[model samples]
Target: MSENTQNAPRPIDIKLHQASRLLEIKFDNNTECMLSCEFLRVYSPSAEVRGHGHGQEVLQVGKEDVNISAILPVGNYAVKLVFTDGHDTGLYSWDYLYDLARNYESLWIEYLGKLSAAGHTRKNLS
Candidate 1:
């Protein structure tokens, strides 16, 4: 195998648990992560969320109850997640997904901090 191929992380399985609002992904490198739908929605890589450049990320609010409506494959390298709120632009690459999984805790903490800084409180879905 080429060096790039050997080092690149790839998903072996991806499952969306609607009831739990979690997306479970298992990678070929033996890493397994369960990411919340809200997290994914808030951290969407689309321009609408990420913006066109640095320091332009739009703070996502009211996504505590958001869920994945669909997962569409993007070639062999990524998947496009269609969110219930009508967001379907981000193409989540394998590397990006792996990074999200591995850094979930810290990233979530950062997100919470941002929310708090913006004076936004999270409301749980009833």
Candidate 2:
């Protein structure tokens, strides 16, 4: 857990904008990452989304139209996401969120490239 914590980054502020499908996050430890809702949805930490155990990630599909239904706080370091698709299990920690935010550009581009390579279409997250 300590190693995981150490690898995770820390964010000072996190904002979820449903209107533009954007999750804007700022880290006091010196970084900022503006991530898209679709990006977060596809990269969700839930077992349903990620699969059980390590190296078993299941590629998410049709998340192009997914949205966050609600954001619930979890203790001092986590946030629970209730997706519009009714998924509400993943507990996204502040550190995890920070990492996601910090790596958004690279990850987003990767996601786009992967989608394109797979001939998949992200039809706007509603």
Candidate 3:
């Protein structure tokens, strides 16, 4: 196998916890993370959220309660996340998902900062 293929992180397990609104993922490299649905929705890789270029990202709001409705496999490389809010465009690749998991803390903080800068307050889901 090529070095790139050998180094690629693959998902060993993926589970969606509906009640807690978290997506738990374990990678072949022994990395594990629980990503919140809201986080995933806001950081969606779709053009609708990420836009067509840099500095064109659209801030996502009111997604505190969003949950995964379905997890559809995309060949052998990725999964199509069907959100409860009807968003199903972003294809979450193995690498992308691993990145998200590893960077969850920093990414979530950045997202919150952006929301605050936009004058949007995130509602308490509890």
Candidate 4:
């Protein structure tokens, strides 16, 4: 339980755009962000995606075609995202979402760098 979780802005609206493969979220603090489904799937905050400890992350590949199939609310704190690729474990917390939105560009760049270094490419799931 992070301190930001206690004060983080809640989502005012959440829209899923399947055609564009993005999740648009508007927060109460007037901060809005469009998170790509591929981004969310690769950055999922689950043990399966992130692993159990630092430096243990299993790099996600072939997620360029991922999309949100469903979004289920988790109490008052988070949302469970069900991805089109059959992944349904990550719980996106409000604070986490805010952080992701705020740091999206940098995080994405970093992810790309990692993928390149590992000789992996994001591909359409067929």
TM-score of each: 0.93, 0.80, 0.94, 0.92
Best by TM-score: 3
| Tens digit per residue, CA lDDT, model 3, 1-126 | 122344688998999999999999999889889999999999888999999988999999999999999999999888999999999998888878887887889999999999999999999978
On residues 75-98, what C-alpha lDDT tens digit does candidate 2 reach at each position? 877889888888788888886687
Q: lDDT of each prediction vs. the true structure? A: 0.90, 0.76, 0.90, 0.90
User: Candidate 4's residue-wise lDDT over 7-125, tens digit each?
Assistant: 78889899999999989999999999999999999999999988999889999988898889999999988899999899999799998888889899999999999999999976645
Q: Model 2 scores what on Cα lDDT?
A: 0.76
Pairs of residues clashing in candidate 1: none
lDDT of 1 by residue, 50-84 (tens): 99988999999999988999999999988999999
Which runs of model 1 end up more than 4 angstroms from their true locations?
1-6
TM-score of 2: 0.80
Off by over 4 Å in 2: 1-3, 7-9, 124-126
- TM-score order, best first, reads 3, 1, 4, 2
Residue 6 local lDDT, model 3: 45
**Clash statistics: count for each candidate:** 0, 0, 0, 0
- TM-score: which is higher, 2 or 4? 4
- Name the runs in model 4 displaced over 4 angstroms: 1-4, 123-126
